[model samples]
Target: MTSKTTTRGEPAGPSMTYSAIQQPAAMSDAGNVLMNWREWKTLFDCYIIAAGKEKASSREKCALFLHVIGKAGREIFEELDLDDKAKTDYDELVLRFTMHCDPARNVNFERHLFFEIYQGAENLILTQMIRGIKGSYMRERLLAISKLELDDAVSWCRAEEGP
Candidate 1:
């Protein structure tokens, strides 16, 4: 018997169809660049996967990414310090955009701020203890230990008070 196939809406044969992938919205807010980039990048990634372009060549993927990012994104891409080879690399392009979107944090300054807050809390505890102590001698002792280690100050208070 001869093989037969039926088509629901079209002739029975191998066929392929592609729907237009929606472009992600262009980033607009300067203050929210990092947040906007993160959102836009997510949408673009979904677009790539939905369009069956995950296996596309690096150059082609890079081109598609650049195209979908809109005018401002293109400008930012142009400003990125990419070498010739990197220009054709999708991962390199993504890295450059990520760096551009998210600025490097000042680790030293952050550490200093953290220590300042921690020291402030310790000083507050010492000040509160000095105010609440019954004797002037105890208050003086607490004040002296304020400039020393917090653990030392606590141990001094505990030792002077007894069990």
Candidate 2:
């Protein structure tokens, strides 16, 4: 008999483990895919903060992230329900990570994390990441983030490096 699967195409099991989530399995060299998953979600949350969209505000971003986390089988959202500090820490981390990339001022972090994650997925998946970020107010930063190469991201972020 065949097992039922999720509409998004996930298996009916308790969600894939981080190890199973890697597309190429070879890309597993980046260390703890689950951590990267959490980071990507956090980074997306920060982008919403930068966008300042009234309909899709930071609170809504957090809610969206909770949905993402739930689908990923991560219990973090439930933990945050009782732990105010966890929620604060997640918010603060998102704020600190993207502080320099503020649309009102400068760009930092360069969104390398998403690029790295994208490089591991299919080309179509990377396209989705780019399109997902296009909703951001910082269009330039979003474009830069969309184009960043995983290997060159470090050098790309160095401010003192001469052009």
Candidate 3:
């Protein structure tokens, strides 16, 4: 009888071995809790793809997710306000975990803070420019002006450098 050899030089037999994908680490970093959850979820997604379980049933996927998330994650999962159907849904479970890890953001508050920082940075840059002026007269004139803005400074400098 002729024997068939496998790609790894082993004989193709009924007792061939297969290795399962390694599970991702649990999300447990208290300091970086959100980041830890995001990273762990990404790794778990990769594991699902590697293990050829992408087409698995919702319940099966949910089970796999719970198993991989470890004790702390399971405790959090238990606290989530999900109905029976949602509890068995993989997507719903992921959404709940994501929401738990990341709190809701206030867009208006975030925008206000961003503008505050932006204005501060702009003022800093303008101050540095005035300080770096080669002409002492120009520097003193700019600094002496009360409530001087960037546009006013530029206009004043341009007027001084007239043709």
Largest TM-score belongs to which candidate? 3
Stretches > 4 Å off in candidate 1: 1-18, 111-163
lDDT scores for all predictions? 0.80, 0.45, 0.86
Candidate 3 lDDT over 39-82, as tens digits, reads: 89999999898777899999999999989889889989988989
Better TM-score candidate (2, 3): 3
TM-score ranking from best to worst? Answer: 3, 1, 2
lDDT of 1 by residue, 56-156 (tens): 99999999998888888999988996899999999999999999999898998986677678768776566566678888897786676536666776787
What does the lDDT read for residue 134 in candidate 1? 85
Task: List where candidate 3 sits over 4 angstroms from the true fold.
Answer: 1-18, 121-163
Scored by lDDT, model 2 comes in at 0.45
Which structure among the candidates has the greatest lDDT? 3
Pairs that collide in candidate 1 are none
Give the C-alpha lDDT of model 3.
Answer: 0.86
Q: Write the residue-wise lDDT of candidate 2 on 1-163 in tens digits.
A: 9887767666777654223222111111156545555466555545444444325645554555454444332343332233454454546534432332233522344455655665565554545544654335433453567566533433433432357
